[model samples]
Target: MTVFRVGCPHCGGRAHLESGEVRLARTRSRTFYAFTCPDCGEPVRKPAGERIVELLTGNGVAEIGLAPR
Candidate 1:
């Protein structure tokens, strides 16, 4: 399983999440990712640039939402 190490702003800790646990949203000009913090169960969302989107998608993280016009 692919695991991503992400920082949890809620608990101020780092969490390891599987690819399935993450949601990626992308558009022509922007990209972002969201996941629930395993440590605190809080929903976390953050901006993702091109490189971040590439790395996450390359590792099998699922893409979500519609691309903007």
Candidate 2:
């Protein structure tokens, strides 16, 4: 499995996470990626662009689509 490096805002620690640890959420206006920091167990979320979405999905990150209101 591919491992991704992400920084945790709550603990200020860098964590290496696998694809199973990441989640991709898509909304009408934007996309977001979320993960729990292994080092600190803090929930982290960040905005993702097309490139990021491509990369994350390619690595097997689970994705959920949000219905537009």
Candidate 3:
């Protein structure tokens, strides 16, 4: 399966992207490409696989966490 190497800017860790549907920790199904940060222990959601670049570069982080205070 094709995977994306995602780096966690917060913890400076890398995450492997998974193919197909993404089931959250609670087993909730999500209709989007996603990745999880092993180091920071965070989940990332992508609108599409092709848009993985934006997520890695600290884009659209709203889905993962929230805006800076």
RMSDs, each prediction? Answer: 1.8, 1.4, 10.0
Model 3 clashes, total count: 0
Q: What is the TM-score of each predicted model, taking all chains together?
A: 0.85, 0.88, 0.37
List, residue by residue over 1-69, the lDDT tens digit for candidate 1.
899999998899897889999999877777889999888889998999878988999999999977485
Using lDDT as the measure, which candidate wins?
A: 2
Residue 1 of model 2: what lDDT? 99
lDDT of 3 by residue, 5-46 (tens): 666656777666543223212123332445566777777643
Poorest stretch of ten by lDDT in candidate 1: 23-32
lDDT of each: 0.90, 0.90, 0.45
Whichever of 2 and 3 has more lDDT, that candidate is 2
What are the runs in model 2 whose C-alpha is more than 4 Å off?
Answer: 67-69
Q: Please identify which of the two predictions, 1 or 3, would achieve the higher lDDT against the true structure.
A: 1
What's the candidate order when arranged by decreasing TM-score? 2, 1, 3
Clash pairs of candidate 1?
A: none
Candidate 1 or 2, higher lDDT? Answer: 2
